[model samples]
Target: MDGDDRAGGLTRRRRWPWVVLVLAVVVAVVVAVLFLANDREPEAAPQPADPEVVTLPVPTPTIDPIDVEPGTRFFESLPRTVLEYALTESTADQAAVASGAVEAYRLVLGDGGTTEVVVLASQWRDADAAGAAFDELLAAEAAAAGIPVDQVGTPTGSADDAAAGEQTQDPAAPTEEPTEPAAPTEPTLEQGPVEVDGTQVGRYLLVTRPDGSGTVHWTNGTALLRLDGPATAVRDVYAAFPL
Candidate 1:
């Protein structure tokens, strides 16, 4: 379900901003054409002028995953935590955010190593819900791994601060970056990864390296989650949920 936001006497869809921008572009092109025609120099009254026509491109908004399929089973079965994070977290990448669903799996063969994969779906009630669900899923995934949930959750703010720093301190800027009113804000919820069973869950791959190991994070409006190590196994599992 698309979440509803209302105030005063006016009611508008949550997705209206992108729509309005596209329309503005269309209006501009139309006005430009009219003005050009009005200023055309007048020719001799008796001479018939050849007709000239111009075509302008109209703006088209990109479609979200939710628009193509709303409330599909792919979205319904998604773990709540994953859903929460996708809707809330601002750091989600565009490809993941655009995807309407998420899928990830690891094959724990009797062998020593693990095979894994993860995918996110892009369909949801709204941004708020998507963010909340994504964070929750990350917590659950981390818990499945040996990592302490606190480590995952505790990093939320610091990660956000780091992200904000990157957004503001663009290298292209000549002087110190000035903060603007429209600058991206930090996440609303406190979050971190979880310990899955006793193992430290890597959203993509759990590593035992000289440095450190962790999962990969991916998210979208309707889907968000982490995958620990390798992608093959998780990718296979994700395929089943597409119906």
Candidate 2:
């Protein structure tokens, strides 16, 4: 029995090379199968990006920075001498575009009650300039309304005039100057243009007439130039502002 076992061990040693070759062939076959299974069509090419949209800015006359509540006594009780009104903020921090330190404006005309003439702006030098522009605009619009610019009663120098004229029994009465310094008053919004800092981006809706359409313009914090005419109709003239 011992001799027979010895012969079997010798025979198995001689066949080892054949066994290794068979194992190698089996591995190769499996790898080929896997490779074929994983083979697939090439991926499609990436699509190109779309072109950017371009829009041109439209300009118009500037207005005061103030919010107007519709159908209110403030709207109905507007002075006849006042064509429009606004209460612009001294600083953009208190304005709609305060986040950008940009100037803003709103207008309310004297129709049956108050018709918002035009309100759009979002860039300026400072709030004081905005207030100044409001005064100027009020004066201009009043002049257009056949009232003398001097009699527009701009709330200049002191802010108390805003309260004096606003809460007074007479909206047409001249505002008395304040005797003592008071805390800065919130801007009073009347329908008209508001001033801005020397360095401001102003766009406006320049209404030629209450019945007729108006033009729009842009300002480099200086001159007001017409950027759009009757052919260019826009809902919000300031929508075309780049700022």
Candidate 3:
């Protein structure tokens, strides 16, 4: 072979090896980039959270008082004075039928015509009838006061039964010694029975109105009575009332 041809062949062999090395390096770089891309994790999209729920309490309903016109019959049974208040006006034969009573009377007593006290008296057929009527009246009063009926009064026993000592004890049942009533755990809306000389004379419910006035309803014998006046004065008037 000629010298020139041999030199050219050597140069070509060296150039071929360099080209193969460059191709190998490029292939390795491409494989590394693909592997890294496959190993990476994708980011997740954000989602909305559930809305919170809230509950509210219901409110008690209010009641309005009923009005009646003055009647003609004389209310002779009503007391002339209750504490410092004096009877100024009276009416009868107005609420008898509605109250399920044989007779009904209403009396207004006040200081100098200011109208501080009002008295309502009704007579039923018997103690049972009066008690039923009293329950109805108390329920109405409780509704007007926005309180539960159970919170109105706690009658130990009927006035007639307690007065007569007629409550019979069950001989077969175990006799438990009288225990003092537990102190009330919660606030009471009204008082319980009215006692005189350790005898339960009646049950009274004292409910205050929105105008700051008060009402007292009680039952004695066959009579159901109600007294309305100042929040502080009604209790005194009710205690002084004879009915």
Candidate 4:
């Protein structure tokens, strides 16, 4: 029995060396696989970059700096006159345009009391110039402005003296009595209040005859342009005019 035990022990010892050799081979194979995996390149998926955005500047609106009011522009279109009168802020009211109108027109004047037109104005050199201009525009070549006659006054005198002078004249006589013609009626002006730099500088309304029609009229500047309708019509004359 002892000899058999010793033979079994020898066989076990020989198998132990082969097991150690097999373990060493398995460890070497594992290390080689790990090194190869580390050295190999990794796969990557490409992603697109975010797009860029562009911005533009917005445009701004434009505005007119001038007074540009219809009435203001009406006066402004005329020849240069007193700055105050030219620059004066005026209301554009509806006016009546007589059928008799032309390129050079005379506006039928308006009365402040009864008519819708303005019978008074400023900046003309004189009444003669104003009337002359009106007449020229009406029946002549110059631009016509409206002129209005306001009130017809009664002359102060004795009717008896006129009757006695008439009675003395002989009806049978061929010669007629010479008499001096009465003076032409002049417009009596009523002034408006003028303000200069916040102080009073009394301004006044100018009076003129309206034309063939006995009426009154008013305006601001010289070299008149007679538009024959209402204030809106005056504004309608130009589309660019600012009302």
Number of the top-ranking candidate, with TM-score as the measure: 3
Off-target runs (Cα >4 Å) in candidate 4 are 44-48, 52-243
lDDT of 1 by residue, 15-45 (tens): 5877899999999999999999998898758
Q: Write the per-residue lDDT of candidate 4 for residues 1-243, one digit (tens) a residue.
A: 899899999999999999999999999999999999998888676887888887754322132122434434334453221211122223332332221211122122222223222112223444445444454333321112212322222233579989998899889979868899755354322223334467643322322322322222222223223332234322222122111
Model 2, position 70: C-alpha lDDT score: 47
Q: Rank order by lDDT, top first?
A: 3, 2, 1, 4
- TM-scores of the candidates are 0.23, 0.22, 0.51, 0.21
Considering every candidate listed, which one attains the maximal lDDT? 3
Residue-pair clashes per candidate: 68, 30, 0, 25
What is the alpha-carbon lDDT of model 4 when measured against the actual structure? 0.37
Residue by residue across 1-243, what tens digits does model 2's lDDT show? 999999999999989999999999999999999898789666788898898898855322245434444443322332222222233322212443453334343333222333333333334456455445544555555665565555333445567766675676676778787897665332222233423554435434343433334544444343222322222232243333322
For model 2, the stretches where C-alpha displacement exceeds 4 angstroms are 14-18, 37-39, 42-115, 118-243
**CA error at residue 109 for candidate 3, angstroms:** 0.6
lDDT of 4 at 98: 28
lDDT of 3 by residue, 119-198 (tens): 88887788788778877777777676556787455544678887565457556778679999876433235768767779
Comparing 3 and 4 by TM-score, which wins? Answer: 3
Residue 189 in model 1: shift from native, Å?
Answer: 18
TM-score, prediction 4: 0.21
TM-score of candidate 3 on Cα atoms, chains taken together: 0.51
